[model samples]
Target chain A: MASVLASAHPQETVYGQVGDATVPLRFSSLDEEYKVLRERAAVLDLGGHGLIEITGPDAVAFAQRVLARDVEYLTSDRCMMTLLLDADGQVVDQVLAFGREDGILLESSCGAGARLLAHLRANNDEGVEIADRSGDLTVLGLEGPYAWGVVGRLIDGELASLPFESVVDTTWNGADIVFARTGFTGEYGYQMIVPIEHAADLWRQSLEHAQAAGQEALELAMLEVRQPIPRHEVTEGATVVEIGANWLVDVTKDEFVGREAVLAAFEAGGGRRTVGFSGGDGVPAPGTRVWVNGQDIGEVVHAVHSVGLGATLGLARVDHDLAAAGLELTVGGTEVTTLTSPYIVPKSWSIPII
Target chain B: MTIDELRARAAERQQTCSQIKKMIVSRLDLEIDPDWITDDQPLFGRGLELDSLDVLELYVAIEAEFGVALYDSEMAVFGSVSRLAEEVNPALRA
Candidate 1:
């Protein structure tokens, strides 16, 4: 799937491993690509993300038992961010579940589709049908302040009216397409899923539409800066509470895969919380050791030079007390200060009505 | 109150507002200068554009700085710097 995108940018494109796939790390200069996303709209190919479908009479029940978020209450029009966990409360993957008439569609990070599908099958006592649809579906991300406007020109009906995490199935150029008001970027954005055969056509049309609207297309490098924490940071050993994703854990639910462990961890106060840090003279690469007064506290998970903030920003798992804003820490022998996530608060965060 | 006392009180209030503005910038690690934050500019929506989680950080900052614990019900006072200033002054006086 990525070969199609690679063929387009023969001069400036570079590929890197995201999950199991080698995706475009950048199409051109990182700063310029990032600038387009911050100032205007840009389209990104997120074909690596895993898509799985679970259907049957017991689909909702099976999902509710396995996922951290309350899947039982999710309706056909809405989507919810959830986490799949091991029995020991370690995070397996972060997933977004969209409720549809046939069943529930789950989208996970790259390289996690098979594991998630296997987990579902192992726990499926209710005869739910599970299928991995990653190869068949292509995910495209449209981001920036003007993303809504660009998407509005391509689809029917008013897209602005759709709330965040709302999913709507629509047709584009005689082919079926699904649009979700969800994105990793802390801006107005949408994720469009199309059939694999129509992906190249959709990608071309989306870029053309965005360019016609005086916007530039972006690549994965731009998207990385927008995300507060990368998925790799929360891999296998990390818990939801430790990652500061406690909001996604529905404690009111009677049971889930790792509910007991998570509850116990919550009561005991999980160690090594995820914190956002910025204002360092040098960008701390991922896996860099974070220190406090010469003591090794945690390690950097995601780091990037934020052109918008005019400083290097990174996310790390540090001591919980040090996670508060204004605390100073050392990364690679240089001092850096902590800040809250969504490092650059977008106008969308201000729109309380949404 | 006498004119002199009223003037003194106003000056003290202005000082507190300035302090809170600086505290907001420092505690939130805001990129902009403290002086850039106008009194009427909102702390959450539109102006500063802080989310609810950021508000939690601000709560901790306010308590640690002014020894005033902000209750959830008092969050309405965070509409603007002036509003927060108005709420914090009485707590400081107490």
Candidate 2:
């Protein structure tokens, strides 16, 4: 189904594997897409992300036992970021769990659907039903400071007052669509989920609306800059604490899988910490070794030349001691100054005072 | 101020420090005991080993607990429990 959207950029699009599907990588120049996403608004195809639906009476209770967040406390009108972990506290998949009226919907990496479903079923206490809806659902990502305006124009209800991570259901031309005030681009954005039949039409309509409204379409690469921590770093053998996502883990919760392991790691002090670096001579490719004091400390997980920040930014999992900002580290033999994540703050989302 | 008044003021400051220390421990989900947090021990780097994210969480927790807002520029106040007490006590009094 995403191939329909990918077809639009036939000449300029590059294909990349995201989970089980090959989605459009770049519709145009990376820099242009980055600029559109930063300065204005842009639409992105998030069709590659897997969507899973869990229903029945035990759905929420079962999820609360498996996921690493306070799933039981999640309100039906909102969504929360959660992590699936192995018994050893290693991250399996990062997911956004949306509490729905009927059940819970989980959006995760494409390839993780089967595994996640299997894990859920193995622990299922009966009266629970889980189904992979990735093939039936298509997600469109609208991001930037002006993204809310684009979404506000399409939906019938008022979205201006909606808080982040809140989900609202609406219809477009008789097609059922769900818009969630959530995104990975560190901007005020929405991820719209529509039925597969309406996917192509909705994608085209969203693009047409943005274009008519004088906004540009962004490629998926724009996500590289806005991500607080790249997905690979979190999924590849990095614990939640090591990635500085301790806030996501509810240690007070009773008996979630990997809770004990995570608690132990936190107590014993987790290993390498993920930190951001910038002002480098060039963009250090992923897996580039990071050197400190002539010693190999760690390697870069992801790096890109950020047009918005006007510097080559990279996220690296380095020694915990060197994770502090303003430290100088050598990445791919070029000196880079370490800085914190969200190098460029979005104009739309403001940090709440309380 | 009189000697008794000075003693009472010192006691109030000490109570604030303990409250802040407990908040940090509970909020960050740290394993360390609140009693281990000395008044002068640095919250970041060598002392508590808290990184930038921890500082942000601590700021939010402090605001939620004490109704005192900590600005990004005033991060140095988080350098020690005593400093946090100094910042939070006035707000609590107010």
- Candidate with top lDDT is 1
Write down the TM-score of every candidate. 0.75, 0.75
| Candidate 2 wrongly placed segments (more than 4 Å) | A1-4, A7-11, A125-127, A211-230, A350-354, B1-94
RMSD of 2: 9.7
- Summarize candidate 2's per-residue lDDT along A164-215 as a digit string, tens digits: 7788887788988887887565566788889978877777777765531111
Docking class of 1: incorrect
As a TM-score, model 2 comes out at: 0.75
On residues A88-145, what C-alpha lDDT tens digit does candidate 1 reach at each position? 9887777889988878999876556667777878878889999888778878888776
| C-alpha-based local distance difference test score of model 1 | 0.67
| CAPRI rating of model 2 | incorrect
Model 1 regions more than 4 Å off: A1-11, A211-230, A347-354, B1-94
